[model samples]
Target: MQIFARITSPATQSLTTYRPTPSTISFTVSTRPVPRTLPARLLFYLSILVRIILGILALALLWAKWRITFPIEGDISKGVRAELTTWVLGSSAGQAATRISTRLQWRLLIPGALGVLWGVCRRGYTEESLLVLSGLGIQTSTSSPTYLSTATTRFIPTTSIQDIFIHEAFKGFEVRFYLAIVVQGEEDVVVVFPNLLPRRRILEEVWRGARACLHELQPKSKF
Candidate 1:
């Protein structure tokens, strides 16, 4: 991730970026990731995909869990099972696998499904973003944990937005700064970067940039 301008706190260990354009201002914070190359990113996702596929295969195997001799004639069932098991799993390993599957039943499938779920919850880089569009509106979005899920987003039109400002609140024991947008009709204010909750300096920079972009105003002369 490229950080154009930011204020990092060793205590929080957050990565923040601010980008302003002629008509928009955007700010984002990421709590994960160490900056990867193109190939590395591809490989990272590929690894996660491979793990999910493996978990799926584990569950699929239960569906085709080698019926063996469950419905065959009593006397010849063993012989037929031995032949079929050997044909598929090859000699000793085949018979052993069938026995384990028969004994475990759903015990095996549950683990595989849980493994897949765990993979789905492992979000490599968690990011939260705030986007302000000059005459349009403002939006807040949180990146999804896994590739299977979509980002969570909310958009408030410019008309509904009453004001945007920073406020202080007790997060744990220390007071942290957060940006909030007051909506015209809503009882609760919408908080930006809810998860990341960057420092005040970063929030102030974003506040200024957002106002300048949304109002089409240039900074006053310092002199």
Candidate 2:
């Protein structure tokens, strides 16, 4: 079985070592990934395309000659905080011009809203958790151990581990992977990493490490 001896933890910003019962296999799962595969590269390009479309729509609004007023501006620690207030002035052509102005505002706002939503959803993909396998059972924790009450920290016996697999899936705008540890009579435990390391290598290494750990434990043996 393939084993990664030293793996870096993106959450705690430290190296993590796993030596379960003398037979040790470990690897780090970081965010940055190398996508060389066809489908992986395709997804990466698709995400870029989405971002470009959003940017074009934003530029179109700016080019419409809307009156912009900065109603709020202040000094902060290193920069100034400001708000851009934009509006369209009705032309002298009467009610028809007024209607057009209102319509333009709605048109700009609709695409703007979609862009914001897309960005928010994309950023939500970064969440952190760690998994440790040992002789007696599997231990999981958030990097912040003191926040155990609010985090996922637990020990599941080897027998209780129902399904174990590495999920190489796209989360939002990123193509990240996670160790999906499903336990019997319990919800699955997913150890996800932030986007801070090589993507494909981490996926392959983590999958190999997790599989090695599971192989040693022999938890009903699911791929």
Candidate 3:
């Protein structure tokens, strides 16, 4: 009975008695989807279009104002004086004053209008925007040799020679040649020119005058 039971039992079966072959399995892998690149291209083109439009407008406005002078005659000094006179006179001045007033108004209006248009158009381009922002409110003046010479001579009498030397040497070309003396304080004087160049002779003369003044103030000191 035990032998019959063993013969029927699965555990008692030998390795050679019966065997089943293993089956191989196959798998299918899905490929990943490619990313779309159209958005990036669209952004690049938009940026380029903004830059071109801004550049063209800025150039056109600049060209229009290139040879055109403020105050019509390029006489800023006279225009300023005339404008101030008109303001002071109120209604007393006659036809000449009226014509001058009209001209000044146009001079101011034309440049101001052009500037506004340029600013609006320039906002579109990144490079032009950067440049315009960087130079906002900055102005440049080119002084003739006569102006520099006259300024140096005129400044000496008003300022202490010592102060002038120290101011010129320490501050250099930054002192406003025209209105250095008229400025009330040290800081104002420093800020006025901020980019002026004094001649060597002028520098030496200022130094000598300052030293003499110092000697007069302190006779005991050799300086």
Number of backbone collisions per candidate: 0, 7, 8
C-alpha local distance difference test of each model: 0.72, 0.50, 0.34
TM-score computed on alpha carbons, candidate 1: 0.64
TM-score, per-candidate, Cα-based = 0.64, 0.36, 0.19
Q: Write the per-residue lDDT of candidate 1 for residues 118-145, one digit (tens) a residue.
A: 7656776678888878888888999987
| lDDT: the better of candidates 2 and 3 | 2
Model 3 clash pairs are 162-210, 173-196, 173-197, 174-193, 174-194, 174-195, 174-196, 176-193
What is candidate 2's local distance difference test score? 0.50
User: lDDT: which candidate is best?
Assistant: 1
lDDT of 3 by residue, 1-223 (tens): 9999867743211111111211111111111122258887787677658756655544433433432333334465468766664454354433333434445545664575566555544322110000000111111122223211221112222233223233333444444222122233445442222222333443344334333432443336566
Reference-based TM-score, model 2: 0.36
Query: What stretches of model 2 exceed 4 Å from their correct place?
Result: 1-135, 145-152, 187-189, 192-198, 217-223
What ranking of all candidate models by TM-score puts the best one first? Answer: 1, 2, 3
> On residues 97-160, what C-alpha lDDT tens digit does candidate 2 reach at each position?
3344346666666576556545634532223434545444565544332221254456677678
Global fold similarity of model 3 (TM-score): 0.19
